[model samples]
Target: MDSLKDVTLRPWPAPKKEELSQEDLLVKIEQLASERGHLRDITEKSLQEDIDAGKHIPDDTNDAVKQEAKEKEAPSRQERLEKVFNAGKEMYGHLEWAKFAATNALDLLSLVLSQDTNKRNLSTFSQTFREQGLNQGIPFGSFGISKENHEFHNRKPEELQRIQELEHKQKVVAQGARMEALDSAVDEILQAAKQLEKEVRRQTKYWQEIVAVSDQGWPLQRLRQNARHVPFGVRYGLPEAGDHFKARGFAPLQMDKDGSIILDPALALKPKTFRVRVSIDGKITGTSQLEVEVDTKDHSIQKSIQLARDSLFEEELYHEMSLETRQLLAYGVEFRDSVISVDAPLMGSTSHDRKLLIDCIPREDIVADSHHHEHDWLARNVAEALRLLLAHEHSMRLYRRSQSPPPLTARTQEQAPPPLLRTLLAVFRHLEGVDSLYVCLEMVANTLNSAGLEVTLDTTRETSWAILAESLKEPSKRGLSATDQLLEIFRKPFDGRATLTLPTSNGVQFESLTIVTRTIIGQPTFGTEHKLTLPSSLTSDLHLFQQLKFSSVKEVTSYLDWILPLHIAHRLLKSEYSSRATIKSHDSGITISSRECKRGSAFSTDIKVELLEGKLKATALTASPLSETEHTEQSHTWNGGHSSTSFKQVIQNWVG
Candidate 1:
């Protein structure tokens, strides 16, 4: 940087004044100071001496500026007081004239605005002012002190009459102007009356329409701004909707030319509906119902509100599903080009695979996916379930807000969004998985019962739904109503269960097995799960320890097919034959060592029972030297056109 430019300092000299010594002001000040005894300077002495000697300085401090300032202070204050008094006199006179003028102006205005034309005029008003002695203190009018130079008395009669003529002409001109003003004021009054009458009619019509809208049961709210044509707004959206949708719910009910309410811009967008279609083998099987058709030209307030509300619901549903596609990448879910692709099979098998395609389309759009209506119920139920879940989410949003909020903190904890789509998926997965297993179990139990064995079977769709009536009989806690508590069901995991008892021990024994199906969308569980809990008697010798969990329905069924047969062969049959029947190898096999009726020989038969395809198969083999045919073996399968039979009968025929 260049050195800062040299700046020359300008000297401002003090003004010269005559010495005050000529007036003896300095001499008198010195005499007063001498009498008062000035403080002696101790600069030459040590600092200790200065401290020891207490000093006093005169009030003026022997400074010229201080003495001058002190002397000028008194005179300046006195002059200020005199100036204030004079100002008060002037202000008081002005105030009195202003008061009189205001009162007189008010009287004149009232006279001008009066219903009847006034007989008095401006000249009379001025004469009254002069009577009040206004001219003496204020500049009121042309009246003034008489002077000899003005010599009106010495003027000739002709000159005085001419002056009088001029004054009369001036009065005539002022009167004409006042008369014109009165005419203008009359015209204005007529115009104002017409406008007021029209305004009254318009206000009446607008209020009547507003009353109609309010009476329709739609909530009305006052608009703080934009009340020019529309003074109020309607709330049609769900209360616990997302913040953005919540804002879109309110719109000013602007009145149109016919005094009918028109839709606000926020509610005027093209209406759309959510479409959930079931596609099997690239063909549409079912679709959600479309909104009722509406006439565009005759769009009423109620219709518009309904359309906006439905559209908001569809949009939120689409948005939530879109958000879910990110977390469900492992489940073949994709959200591309604003379309959601997901699997929604009715059964847990690839043969019955179905794709659930979700999209939002204009309400008026047409789709004829009516070829196959078999899956239509499934699709419609899916759509309704999703809607119910969204509604449940809205209730939960309010419930969470009513509870005590977490303490304030700088570290932001992002609250998870409502699991509308996740819950829907869980519902589908859980129902399908549990129902499929239960159906197979019923088939197996029927086969065993038909073969002279008593097997008990029981199943429930949902535990909560099973005892819903009993639960509702009791009073609820908190401020939550029964409806809110009922809606709480969707927020938790869905549970389905089934129980079966072994055939050998009958219903009196504690040999039942429970298969519990649980489905949760997030956290530790990412899919449907099933757990088969066996009786402790059978699990003591097995790795199952009475409880085993499976992630899929197929796995749970396969494990049960292996465990149930093993349990029977080792626990039931071994105990029945007492030393004669021994478990050969472990899974689904046993041997009976007994003497034949005639030959008196020992023999062992191996039997294995299991599920094959959709059928049940029981195989038996006997190896003995007691009058038996070579390669003796018996096998039978049920559900594939074969006669149904139980494993116990096969075992008896082989070794007895």
Candidate 2:
């Protein structure tokens, strides 16, 4: 709690000096004058070259005669030096008074310090004299004033030391006070910052709640929750918006439980004329004046009321409203005429208009989701409905504002929309048709661009379908009907059945089928014929096979690496066959052979697969037909193919 006023110390007083005799003073003055004169001489000499340069005038007249005349008029070097000396003498005389004044001031200061009682003053005076005396060539040490005499005139050493100790203590106290004040200030600042942070967080949370309500649309419970949290100053006190409805030429008596605004039957019995104004928030947005004649027995007014209400609160219609319209709805709705006025905020508006219509109608009404058949029509029309709802709400707000009493002061111009409202409207315009499939396709195109794929939706779709059509078994047909046919395009060769076409050495094409079979009753068996044909020159070239295309080699090697172990394990576990499968790759071909023993009936299959002129060739040795047991096993394996598991394993291995 130390105050800033307590942090300052008293200022030190000026020192006194000893008096000098008149003769000595005069001598000192003369010596100082001589020293100043010498200094003046040095300064003048330093500026001599500049002074000479300034005096020189260049000759412009024709050479010989003009040069000779200029030389005669100019002063000689010796004469110029004499003129400079004379000028220096005049300037020295002018400065002599100033020099004398400075000398006398120093003498006066020394005299005052000599008699000063303050020790600090006396010491400062002595130090100043010592420094200046050395600089000016004056004998301050020879002044004949002893330290003892000087000390006796001022404070004693012990007294001066005590004064110094007291001053030090005061300084320490002042510094401590200053530090305490600074600490207190910093603490206050921190507390203020913390309070400011809390206020910011509270405001942020409040705004977040408002935004959530606006975005989600206000349900009854949510509206109530919002009301509870709203500051008292901003809370609207009118009955919920759902309690009222507006119709031309009819005054609403009450709202039914189903949300229809029931008009007075008496008023509706005869011809009547009325004007209606609707407002949302505090602004008038719409007005209608009408004349109506209805039969009391027919309940035509109620029917008209229900129809008007239905048009106002339709869900499909609501979705099509623009941001400006939605903002109006948010402000609430108002209905007014000469005899009656009603106001309803949008927060309490409900989607029960259809139910209300049905309750008031004579016959049952069928409610449909949408009137449009095309998917795009529904999307586009839904947006239009929202815009309409917003526009109606805005009209209601305007009508309400117009009905209120005029203020004492009038505004020169209408207020512009708030910045938040303007921003929301801009966003709505930007995403106007976002629900349409075309817009969705555009969004997808943007996604593809973001992911480093340079593709547009139309181009991508066309290319994909073209590729699919080409791969189909019935390429002539325009439609793909089977799921398996679509899935076949993505299938790989390792799933146990692969049909490969290869050209023979004579240039004729042949087909080879590789089939793997496994069954519960017997060992798994794999059979394939690989026909390998190499060009005559490359028949002995082993390097060609070793340096095959990396991707193709990897596919073949991986398939073998995974399938060989599974085949061996299945044979060993069933105890029906002890099989040895050998796979070797050479320059001309890849050779695969499997020898198995099942119930002492031995069988062997050898396949040679080769790469010849960038085409795969497979050759298989002729083998006997499979017996009943083999056929049943093959059929069971084919029926329960492990496509999904094999595909997953292949993907995992490739990724690793």
Candidate 3:
């Protein structure tokens, strides 16, 4: 079995006249003509059979009508048929004459070929042609027939001439008969073709509808371009816009199914001031009122005020430029003092941090006309512009920072970041969760870039500290501590940098966690070449002390002894405001105290813990005052804070 996929077929040859060469073509034509004659004879026989069966015959191949027609026109049709037969008889006579000529010519050729002398007789042949009504009353050759053969054969010249004339007459009659038959056939075919053409024209409309053709037959693509016209549809016009519409311009448009031409609003004239208008079905049906504006450009401040005269409308611009102006500013150009200011109505109780606009215009008279120099105009305008720019920049940065997630939302609905804060929050959501310190820092910088604030951080220091802080707060969150994990992820570059000091609300947190780590000689070791510290504690009041030094790692565990006790003394003195007398301490401590009126609150607190020398001074501290009669002592205990980890550990946990 041959499947469709498995089947293969040979290519077919193109149709060509050479497929039936001229000689073979002639034979096919003769064969078809013979077959046509037989078909005609069979058709006539079929008509006779119908008549015999008493069935009606139709004219033009209708059997029933032809039968009736044959009966009604029987006699006249027979008479006409006989006349046609007589015409055929005449044509047959010409054929007979041609046959006679061929026979006689053959005999003459035989006689001429047998003759010993070059002379022929044509007189008898000429007499025969005259009797057949073929003589032209001229010499043989002059009549386009040759008698010279007879002369060459030594026959009587006149006889040969007569034969030549008869042959010429026969040839002419045969040719005429062929021409008449051909002419009749052509006329019949042309009449039939005319009828067929009429039928084709009648059916063409039906086909055209089926094909979805227009009158002129242009197809769909041409119509989309509005180039070709279709009936039963209106022609759409080119769009023209003016001040009455927004974004005034011209565009090409087409009518929708609703018969309304929807003009693109972007095509409206004077977009800054104009509103859109829609024209439908040869009538303007939309809101027709035009948005009018007094033309002005030099003073945007005045123009903006006039444009937004209503308080409600003006309030929309409370600290920002108009929507239209903002759109215009998007056209790629840098500005030194392009400020957007809004004067919003104050909303009390709600912080205005997120509120967008502020008072924009100059606080004082911008132009002191008569005496003011042009430079003064620029200075005042530029200065006001600069101030606005700086203030907005500052607010924008703060707004940006507030946006960072996990964005703190107010527990009570009373507090929310201002509109700018919300906007910055939105921006920050996009900025947060960035893994790259550079990128996170860049986002921070970019958020403040437009403001006067300059942000600079040593990547080695600030980033490491932030990583360390995050690790301590949420160990499981960023998987910074895992087995061989930091090496598995990012290559740990050698960090020899020292701790950086960045300004904070509290003095400065060590920028590098390594500073504290190395100082404590923690498990995650800073190599010997790196700065290291000793671990020790002095008094019973402090729990721990970390030794610190430069890359010179040595056990100066003595520093812990000096530092811890002094810190403990300060903690103890916080509650002794009543004592003004000086007390001497056993270990190089000079304490000055004044008992001034004994005017401090009296409370009794106690702490109990021991401090061993270079091992661990897990101490606890609690303030105590001389209570009334020194009777009761309240106790307090303390625990140490969480410790730090290395950068490699941080990355391992984070990556994992």
Candidate 4:
């Protein structure tokens, strides 16, 4: 009874208005709708502003908007939602563009700074060398070799004349007729550097002003503090010490917690105590230590380190300059025994030697062959570095050329054909006669057969004609289908023999031939050699195959210098249908593949060609199989193939 004591309850608050007239209810509804509309407008504007500012919006905001639209079933609400999302996409695009521009600006600044430093160092080296009387010129004897035995020194007189002409042209432009051109170039570079610095300062100030006005603290100061951890010349975007440095005998000694690179002691060229003065905006800012080493009691440490660093920097600068200069001069330049020698072409036909002397500080004599050993390593390193740099330079040059508009002269000039196309055309012209064609085809078939791909020829010519027609529609089906068609025509195993009969004006004639040829084309495979029977008339053409054994694309072009028109033609054709063909090269050889296209409906064809032990080996793979009838038709068409004119057109459409 005590646990069941009565509990007090309070009634809920009465409704403000239980009932009202029609006019009052309408008025209340209108007021409520107006308030809701005002709130919706405020939220929409806020969200739009956030998106425009590249700020992330709360997911709940989106969910709430979507829920309101679902409840109201309003088409306008959905449309507004779409507009907001589109605005976000536009903001993202702007953000990406900003990032790209910033990155490129940093890279450009880094490159300019590095170049300035290098130029300054080079000027110092030249002054020091001139003062030391090292400019007398380097002699061939300094290279520990007789001048008469050197390849450049032994060049013909004609080559020497050509080299002189080239040198004169360069001197006219680079040194100027009055020696003012070099000065002008220098002034331009200096102006560019000043402009770059000014731009950076302007950008920094702009950001700083923004921070001040917004009362967001000094972001510039934060940036500067973070920048202190960045390596000199790398703050913007210089290449880091990595495999490239290591391969040149430089190794990392320590990696600081903040990611600073400390080179290995054994490989460091500069002494620990030696420092390079650094300046910014014409004022001394600080100093940079070139290396790290423990303190020593030896008093000559400073002198040794300074000499070493100077020598290294000079060598590197010279190497880079030589590569750049080579682009303007065709002469072969070599460095040996502190001497730089230029092998100029004499009279544009033969090479002649010219030398310049560079004086270097004598290294401490510790071992008998110490100087020789060190110089050898330096030379090797310079050579390798030059090779890589030149490759990169060439690639960039090509890219720039592609991006820029062509010069007026270039646009108006008639271009020459590629060597490969010219050579192919010449071959076709030489094999124009039916007898010649038959002999060549037999030889080609025998070569394929010997390489493990069986080949047969159509006796009736009908089957070959059909195959050729089908191949015209679908080039990819040509390889394997043609082979199958050849097999069907003979109806027997390939014996590397062919016979043909032709009706002359007066009587019928019989021609018999045996072909036993071996070709190295395609992927490497084991097989016995076949005795290739080339017609006596085609013996000279055999040299083409022999040359191809050692030929890369570039080598092939040079080797076929007499057939430049073909090469030019091939290049033009390749560019026109680049999407259908792919050509790749490696140390071993090149692989060329063609994709299936609408004209023909067969699979792709892949051909790999490489030189193996002085033999040109080629392996071809067909992507799909074909029926006997389709194969026969393709073979027949191939047999009746194109004339020289038509052949050229086909090549233009198909080859890359």
In terms of lDDT, the poorest run of 10 residues in model 4 is 232-241
Q: Tens digits of per-residue lDDT for model 4 on 1-656?
A: 44434656866655767756679878876765553433334567876886799555565786787799889885687899997997798669768878777765644444334334343232333343334423656221131222343223476799999999999999877756556867788999999999888766655554443333235321111233334332121111012212222134322223344232333353345322211222222222232222333443343322333343444443443444433343323224344554444321112122332222222332331223212232333234333333334334333334445575666673475432112111212222222222333444444444333432233543322223435566555544223344333323222111222332211112233222232212121124111112223233223422333112211122322332222122212222233344554544322222234555677754443433332212224334444435423311111012222223332233323322
Candidate no. 1 TM-score: 0.69
Candidate 1 residue-wise lDDT, 1-656, digit = tens: 13434556865654557334435876765765564333232234643564467333444564766678878876677798997997798669768878888878855544444323454343544555555534455333333343354223477899999999999999999999999999999999999998888777877887887787788777999976767777898898888988888888888888776566677887888888888888887888888856456576577667777888888998887887787778887877878777788887766477766888888888888767455767778778878878877877787778779999999999999766667677777777888888898888887677666654577889997898787778777746576667766767777888899998876644356578898888887878788788888878677765567688899777877887787677666766777676787765856777767555575556666666666444667777766465666546788766633344455666676667
Q: Per-residue alpha-carbon lDDT of model 2 for 392-413, expressed as tens digits?
A: 4344444446575566666565
Off by over 4 Å in 4: 1-299, 302-450, 453-631, 634-656
lDDT of 3 by residue, 1-656 (tens): 22443566875764885476668878866765554433334567876886899655433556566678888876677899997997799669768878888867854553444343343345435355545533445333222223542223466889899999999999999999999999999999999998778656644543344234233332222234553222222111111211222121223333333332333232221222111122222222232122333353342322222232222122222323323233323222112243332211122212432111222332222222233232233224322332333234334444445664454676644422122222222222212211122233333333222221222434343233346545455454233334223211112222323222211222233221123222111124322223323223222334433434543212322342344233333332322322421224443232323222458643322222221232212222223345344333222211122224321222123212
Instruction: Choose the strongest candidate by lDDT.
Output: 1
Tell how far residue 85 is off in model 1, in angstroms.
Answer: 48
By lDDT, highest first, what's the ranking?
1, 4, 2, 3
Sliding window of 10 residues with minimal summed lDDT for model 2: 353-362
Error of 4 at 395 (Å): 33
Off by over 4 Å in 1: 1-184, 223-230, 255-262, 368-376, 505-510, 541-544, 596-604, 624-630, 640-650
> What TM-score number comes out for model 3?
0.16
Lowest lDDT block of 10, candidate 1: 138-147
